[model samples]
Each structure stands twice: as structure tokens, then as C-alpha cells.
Target: MFDGPSSRREFMKAAVAVGGASALSACMSRAEEPIPKGTDDPSSLPERQHAWNDVLVHDDAGNVEGPRHQLLLYVNLDHDGPPTEDDRRVLESALTTLDRAYERSHEGLVYSIAYSPAYFDRFDESLPDDLDLPEPRSLAPFEDPEFDRQDALLHLGSTRADALLEAEEALTGDRDTANTVTMESPLTDVLAVDSRRTGFVGAGMPAERQDVAGIPDSKPVPEQSPLFMGFKAGFAQNQATEDYVTLQDGPFAGGTTKHVANIRQRLDDWYVEQDFEDRVAEMFSPRHAAEGLVDGVGDNLGDSSGLTPDIIESIEEQAKQYGRVGHAQKAARANRDEEGNVRVLRRHFESTDDDVASLHFPSLQTGISVFEEVREAMNGTDLTSNPAIRQRVNNGILEYIFVRRRGNFLVPPRRLRSFPTPTGE
Candidate 1:
């Protein structure tokens, strides 16, 4: 997020010292005591752990505020089998990986960390997925109505850093971009452009980022999110879904979902769609197992009842929701059931050639941290419930962390992709 490469590395290294090796050893040292021979079982765990990453926020100047987004993650509590010790190892690996990534980051240019609890947290554990899969909506690819692309200022600016430089230029009237370079404290380009103040994520922010009425706290839906807390995600399933409502083409428009999808729905000018969803593969049609998180979700423990019982029940519920179901593209909305199970129902919607774009996260931390929490909270005896089969506790964490970090990485590659696009056209 900061500007200078070297400074970023140093700052990240310090952050790593706090979140990774140091924290991990503290946990492992206490539990060095071995599990009882007869009580070993893998069927009682919640989920697996996978690779970890980081999320660091920076300003246009040379200040960085970080929770290192990738360091934290969410997990599926409900599974066919119990969570395993291997799952815990992966979780540890992820934390270590994130720290390493940060330690390797550049520390010069714009850098500084906003000190705030809402923006960052380091914890022992959290709740896992129950019978329901989290509601899915657009994750990122935020767009500007004026520029008509995923990012606002960058689409309209001369350089990739234009957005971040907005603040410095405005305050000092300094047109010289090179004059502001700093090696120790780098700044984030995201803070410069619009500088609208990211609510809770911002320094001295007064209110929480606005959310939809019912989205749960787990998914870190930003105030800019189109969905609400408790009801944050949308579900659409096959068998239980009603027929897709045919849409009529009337006068309609598309823009940021945060504005139109709620209060102005009755009007013809309002409708929200996922940003560039058509370009990416979401909700696989002939969904083959793209990634294998579920390779071991179900393992026998010689009995149905065991650790992570809630997660097992949740997966069962999810299967039932999509049971013998079908889908139609004409009209559909993704959502979850009363039990937190995901469900998608076709609905009438206004259509336009232009797709509606919205940012999905900076979702709630609760969802991301759920798995490790259970890993820590569960009885020490239960940790080895299913020693036979290894659980990938970090799988969910990997998914969310990767998604979050991808948004950052995409900043550069996406720009690179755009450079040649016009020439080819």
C-alpha cells in the first residue's frame, strides 16, 4: 500500500514480528503436551487451514496503517468430518506466510498505519460455518460512475499513483510528484484519489461503514457494501428456486450499488449488478471442483456426533437447499436460508447491456476469524478427535485472504492488462 519498496519491506517486517512467528510460538509452546493415545480422532474438527496472506493500508503521503488484511481469515465450521490437527498446522502456516510476505514488502515512499481496532485484530479463534454457506455477492472491482471502470481516479488519472497523490497535491499545491518521495514512511495510493474517508477503516472515523440491513458480522462487508448486516449475503439455489422472472427493458441505469439498490428501487433508474462478474467465473454452471477444499470435508470418525458438529450439520443443510434444483439466467438473486444455508431465487429485474458493479469486502472480521477461534476454544482433548484424517483448517482462510489480497495485486496487473487493450481494439 505504501510507495517506497524498501521502506515497505522494513515496515512489513516489523508487522510480521508482531503477527507471525512470535505469536505462533506462544500458542504452540503451551500445547506441546501430547494428546492421549485412546482419545485421538479427526472426525471432531471444524475445517482445514491453508496458506495465509496480508492486507496493509497506506496513505498517499508516507504513512501506513495496517491490519494486514491477508493475515486474518474465515473458515467453514460445518463439515462432513471433524476438524484435524493438520488443519491447525495449515492455519499456523498461513499466519507464518502472511508475516513473511509483509517482511518482504517495500517500506519507502508513502507509508503510515492508522491506529484503530476496527481496522485490525489479532485473535486466538472465532466461530466456524454452521449449516449455511455464507451469502455470496460481488467482492470487489469497485468502479467510478464517471470513469466507467472498476477504479475511479486511476481510470481518469495520468498515472497509477494519481489517486493517492490527490491529498498531497491538494494540501500543498505541489505539482512536483517526485519531490514527495520518502523512503522510510511510504503512503498508499488508495488514500490520495477520492479520499472520501473509508468510515471505520479511516483514522478518527465517526461511524461504521454502512451495511445492508441484515448481513452477518462475519463477512466484512464495507459500508459501501450493497448488502446489510445479518442479511449480508444473497443465496440462490437450484431445486428450491422458483422460475426466473422475465425482465422487461425499461429506462434503467447502472452505477455503484450502494446508492441505487436500496432506497430507489421503485424508480426505473435504479438497479445493481456485480462488477465484471460476467468476465470472471462465479457460480459455476457445470461446476466442477475448481479448488479442492472439500476433498476431505467428510471423513468417518466411527460416529456422526463429534467435534465441529455444527459445521457438519451446516454442510448437510447446504446440500439440501440445492437438491434437485435448477437455474435460469433471466432473473436471479443469491441469498441464504433461515439456517444460514445459501439459496438463490430467480427474481424479476431490469436489464441493461452495462453490468452493475460493486465492491464486496472489507467484510466483517468475525467471518474471517471464525475457524482459528474454534481451534483454540475447543477442548484440548477434541484437538485430536480425528487424528487419522488431516483437516485443512486454513482452506476458508485461504479463500478469503486470497480474495482480499488479490484486490491489491490486481491493482497492477489489471492496469497492465488495460494498457494493451486499446491497441488490440
Candidate 2:
């Protein structure tokens, strides 16, 4: 059962980050369990490509447990003008190979492909009127970030480290077959891979990889915390449902828009200068800390982050009395719709890529404007009117995180995922 030294397991996780044929080979040598195979009928898959929660595993408390390993392939088309029919066929066949080789689950592999605004700019037509995907811009006044304008983005996830690496090799033509399914076409045949980003998440993972640039040597990451921060996030009640984020009126009716941000975290102060209660106040709310509502890693809170209407509405008062506001409380202001339903479905995961502590924040919504509004609220600019709150101090977790890059993409429906035009034709 893949048992080995803790160092060996940690090395396997690092191999996913440093992905290649060599890394995949090294990782496969340690696999004890047989990797599961997928169905042959690709047409039977779900319509919405982002509909992954049903396939993912859940904790005893019922919160969706995300895949442990993740890989993002950023690629641009070789030829500029709209892709040829041959290009589409090659891309479709490569993607179909993946579908046939692995089940759409954490144990197998779950993936999605998205297109950028720059990608649609090549076409003479425009996207549907109902879609509100705009070019990404600096959300916070204090920060400037490089925008990712690559033609397309492909996200792959799996609980097995070996499965994740092997999939990468297959997509890039480095392997003959995946899960014993012959790969007739490779994505690299039509698209040029610009860059590859990899990451891991779950209990004990952050702790094992804590010997990185941003974290302190004290090794303070809790064994139960899924993230580098000592708390759980993406509570089921706190997130928008998959249907809520899907496009309803456009030709891409089953599709959604995605916004991804790379946030670099410097947690020396989070571990050394701040105490548990104070950290809770910044990450959650002062009321949560004062009420002793959160246990270690916030597992006691269950499926929700405990941000009720009362807690969210009390942000202004709490900021005035406690001299601080929680990150979730601030964002919850603009996160809900007029019907009081959540707006964005955040599927963020932690990363030790480049030997630095960072978070790859991917939020799915019907429109990019919704994500921008929620992030602006997270900035707590409105709270900064008070003397106690500023851009960084007592506002939220912004003090410890830096926004490095931002990108917005349109995740078309499964049928049109190959090379969809703006009109969905």
C-alpha cells in the first residue's frame, strides 16, 4: 500500500510539480494500487464540464474533498486565424482519449478546458451578449499583476500523483497510451504548450512541503489543515452551486466563466507574530474567535464557514469595535445575489510550486463581473474609511498575500470545448 519513508512520499508530491517523463516514471515505481480506468462512451459525460463536485469525494462532515494533485497547461495555438477542421479533430481526439482512459473522479482524473478573451479576439465574430467575460485588470489599488493572455488553459486533477503525471505525459505526446487506452492524438499536435503549473492540497500535504520560501522554519502548519493557513475554506454552504454559476441564456448555456489568480503568501508573521485568536480574527472574524466557534483547522464548523447573515451584516460594527474584519465576512458582502444565494464557486488549492508558498485561486461564476465584485469587497476598501482599517492592517488576510497574476477564461460546454468561436457555432 505505497508505504514508505515520509520523505519518499514528499518526494512523490514534488515530482508532480517537476513533471516530465522522468518524474512520471519515478512516481509510477511507487504506485501500489491499480489506477482505475474510464468509460468508453465520451458522449455520456456531464454537460457542464465544471460539474465535478458530484464525482469528488467528501469528508465525514460532507464537505467536498478536492483532488490532491493538480496540473494546469497553458497553451497557445500555433496558427493565429481560426483553427482548421483538422486542428479541431486532432484536439477532440486527444481529449476523447483522456475521457476513455480515466473516469471523471478523483481516483481517476477530472479535467476542464477554458478559453481566454485574447483567444476569441482572433475570430471576426463576438461572444454571446449574455456572457460578461472581460479582460482581467488590477482589482486592488495597491497591486499590479501580469495578466495571462494565453489562448487556452487546461486543468487536470487527480488524487493519485502518478495518475496526474502520467496524464500530462500523454497529453504532451511523451507517452504512447494512458491507462492502456491508445492515444491516437496529442494536444501538443495542435497547441503549443507555453507553460505548465502544478500543485497539491489536503491534510498533511502543506505540512510536508512547508520547507519553502514563504513559510517560517518553525513548521507551524497544522496536520489537519488542508491549506497553508490554519483553517479550512470552500465550505459547501459558502459556495455557489454548480447550476447557479452556469450560463442559462447563451448558446454556451451549460458553460461558465472562470477567473484564476496566483496569490503568493508570506506567512512568517502569520506563524511568529500572531497568536491563534488574532489569526482567527484576521482569517475568519473577531466574533468567531471571541465566541470560540472554531477548533483546530476549523473542522468543528462543519460544511459552512459559519458566516451567517448576522455575522456578515455585523462587519461594519465589528470592524469599529474589534479594529478588524474577517476575510470571509468582507467578501460575503458582495458574494450573495439579490435572492441571498452565493454567487461564485471558489475551488482554490495550495501550491509549493517554484519552492514558494502560493495559492491558485480559481473561482467559477456566470460572469467575470461577479468575481471582480466579490474580490473588491475582499479588498475591504470601503472599510478603510475608518482609521483602524487600512489596505493591509486589520483589513483581512491581504497583509500576508500578494497577487502575482490574473486571468479570465470562458469554459464552454462539453460539446464545444474543442475550439469554440464567440457565437458558440
Q: Name the best candidate (by lDDT).
A: 2
Question: Each prediction's Cα RMSD?
Answer: 24.3, 1.3
- Candidate 1 weakest ten by summed lDDT: 251-260
Task: Give per-residue lDDT, candidate 2, residue 241.
Answer: 95
Clashes of each: 115, 0
Q: State how far residue 103 of model 1 sits from its true place (Å).
A: 13
Report lDDT (CA) for all predictions: 0.20, 0.91
Write model 1 residue lDDT over 1-425, tens digit each, in one string: 43465444333323322333333233223322321111123232111110011112333332223222111111121222332344334433322222222222222111111111111112223212221112222222321122111121111111112222222232222332222222121122112222221101222110132223222233333333222110111122221211111011111010001101101111111112221221011121111122221111111212111213233333323223322111111011122235543232111111111121122232111121221222222212221233421121211111111121111101111111111111112
The residue-level lDDT of candidate 1 at 169 comes to: 36
- Candidate 2 residue lDDT tens string, 1-425: 33667856876887898888887887888787878988788778998999999999888778887899998889999997988899999999999999988888999999999999999998999987668999989999988999999999999999998888888899999998998898898999999999888887888888888999999999999988899988888888999999999998878999999999999999999889999999999999989989988999988888999988999999999998999999998999999999999999999999888899999999999999999999999999989888999989898899999999999999999999999988988
Q: After superposition, how far is residue 170 of candidate 2 from its true place, in Å?
A: 0.6
